[model samples]
Target: MHMLKKIGFYIVAKFVPLLVIMLTTYFFSRWLTPSQYGQYSLVISIASGLSIIAFQWINVTLGRLIPKSSADVKIKIINSGLILYFISSILVLFLCFIFGEFIEDNFKTSSYLIALLAVALGGFELSQRIFNSEERVLAFGIFQGIRGVVFFSFALCFYYTEYIYPGVVYALIASYILLSTPNIYKLLFLRKKDFIPNSIKEIAVFGFPLILTYVLLYVLNSSSKILLTVMLDETYTGYFSLGSDTVQMIIISVMGVVQLAIYPIVIGAYNKNDEDRYNIFSKSNQWVLLILLPVTAGFIGISKGLFYFLLPEEAYLRVIPIVPFLIIANLFVQLKSLIFDYAFHISKKNGKQFLPVFCGAFTSVALNVMLIDGYGLEGSAFSYCIGCFVYMTMSYLIGRKIFKYPSIDVGFLFKVTVSSLLMLLIVIQIPNDSIFQFVISIVVGALSYIALITTMFYPQLKKYINSNN
Candidate 1:
């Protein structure tokens, strides 16, 4: 129903464009030298980092706040979030300018690239946040599609014109601009404006906790690359990031579908405050694991071939060892996110839930700094794994202490664990022919997962589907 439709739309919107963008980026990297590709990766990492830091939780705040208020009030929240984002972007730009020379000299990015990257970062945050707010899921997809089109088209144009670096930057800037245009138009015209909140203080209050959550979440996710950048060098940072990126494609692509479907359902459940709804939430997590576990195991098992086929040989071969670890870590990270972040937001404990998040963030940052220099990317992976484990454990304890919900299902864990382990075995025993091994691994792993779910978890899924229908 609604959940399926929304999830379907979200997947189409986010993943379709992402697939195009990934293909474009892959080719772009192939066309460029290792150093050039490394620099490209570095700039993108920094831009993403800036977006994370600058986002300030407004998007989450809006998602929570918008439906609760009158349309006018929602408009105000949107405007307020936009204003906050603009100011934050300006602050980020200032910081970049201040550190630009040092970063370029030491970190291998040029000042001009940083400046352009700053603009791209700002636009990306604003437009993406607004897209989430509008819940114009298809529009969001189109926005991403436009970004890919503009980026690849313009870059190719510039590549042909013998302006490589500027071409890439121009592509990014133009794509962001194009993607953001719809929001800009909405902000400018379509003039049924509402009571714009006079003070952003209330919004800030709600958003501040998520800001902490976002940063901690960032640490959980991206701090590895940052630490790698510091502990090793830009080139290693590039390799580690690419490997992380490869695994993340698995996590995010899958999780993205789950989030779109489950989030609004969670919100509806919270609003209703019914145990039945809570059970639905629990079952959904089980379903996510039922699907995610084998996928993760397969990725870990066949990561080398996947990376090699998808990326340049040099980049793929060097980063192969890191992929399996990251894939596992990403699974834990996704679990932590579902149990901790989404669970809290749904249960209305977001206001007072900063403690565990801060604890995890500090732990992640500390462990990353301590580990990455010694073990390089492996250390970062270990830190991520440890941080998410602690965070999820803490969050579950706190969630139980506060809400007394059925925090997790033991049956769900047992089934998923068994399925994941079995799939891992099947995949690891894959043959020497790389392509054949990959194909067999995917087909066999998927069939095994579906078989398990149909036999064990199907009853629960059927009940949920029947109830909804």
Candidate 2:
């Protein structure tokens, strides 16, 4: 019952933020035109790209050390991570200053906004890493929930201002500052005695490789949008980002909550000498597959109506056609981030993880360069999917060998695949003319899936219950 309550809290935490994000997206999709939204998306993407470069290494270092570190050492690691972030942020700001003119012209955004976005983004993310490592689910939930509400409130205020898209960036900066205040306040009490100068060097040496790995991952996700904007225009970029981001939201709403609920246990167990950690990791991966695979299929099944409801008619037409590719690509990305990449972390072979991401980014960029000129949007979308596939599968294949993780669960795979196919067939056959019909079809499909899966698991469920008795 305690576990159940903890899981419930994590869900509320992730769901409130996710719901707010979806609502904001829905409103913004129509309130702002494709061009405006595309530019706004581009601004956020660029800021994210720069921020990861600054924070990824520190993120990797903390993820590895925090789960097992003593209290004093944990303070050292956090303070060191902050120091690294500060130095990196300063470096990033300098680069932005030098490239301010080019950025302003190319991205339709200012260097000032980008820098603020990077600082806020890095701070917020660093705080979450601490929360995740410490297994502070309630704190994680509270902070994330607060950030979402603050963001939405300020976002509405700025949307009507003359600043428009840039106003949205300001709103984000404000929310991040507000949410990270408690984290920042706590840091002030860390003693200078705890700060290790060599710890900085160790973290730097270990985390440097991950910087590129993260940049490659970012490339796998955002390179397409960047290239599309350059080769085509903002409208096409907007269409692609909308489909991709929507699929991402759904994946998070389903799989992310499960991960949050279980991730602390998995990390915590790994810090001690125990065989149970692998089992926990395997079970979590199984949950990811069981939930996401079917959700991916069903998302594609109802994507037409979903987009129609969310986007303006003109944008809907362009977005729906590419959503399948977007869905496939996003599934792989999430799977890699949440599950497979942990193998590299366990082995402390961060460099080995780099190759797959590098290759994936290379493939994505090469394909985009080749395809965008000839086939345009569809071409770029296809490239994104293929690149993600290469990255995800390669990471699993390579990581398992470096450190043996669980083998593929064939029986579970078959069960979910069958259920997903059945759900897909039932959903597509249903007429999806209005949002009302869309809701009904989704409900029917979900109920049908639940019924079938429950039956399939009945034997195991009974056996488990009998064993418990």
Predicted model with the maximum lDDT: 2
Give the per-residue lDDT digits (tens) of candidate 1, residues 1-469.
6666776777777877767756774776576665565567667766665566567466667677775566667777777766676667677777777776566465534555666575666667667666665566677777677778778888888777767765687678778877766556655553335325453677677777666566666666667766776777767777776777757865776676676667655655666656786687776776566656776777777776667666787777777877777777777767766655665776667855666766666777899899877887677777777776677777777866666455567877887778777777877776635667778778887787778656777787799889988
Mark the regions of model 2 whose C-alpha exceeds 4 Å error after superposition.
1-7, 98-109, 194-198, 269-278
In model 1, residue pairs whose N, Cα or C atoms come closer than 3 Å (at least 3 residues apart or on different chains), thus clashing, are none
Q: What is the C-alpha local distance difference test score of each model?
A: 0.69, 0.81
lDDT of 1 at 115: 60
lDDT of 2 at 303: 84
The lDDT of model 1 is 0.69
> In lDDT terms, how accurate is model 2?
0.81
What TM-score, computed on C-alpha atoms, does each candidate reach? Answer: 0.84, 0.91
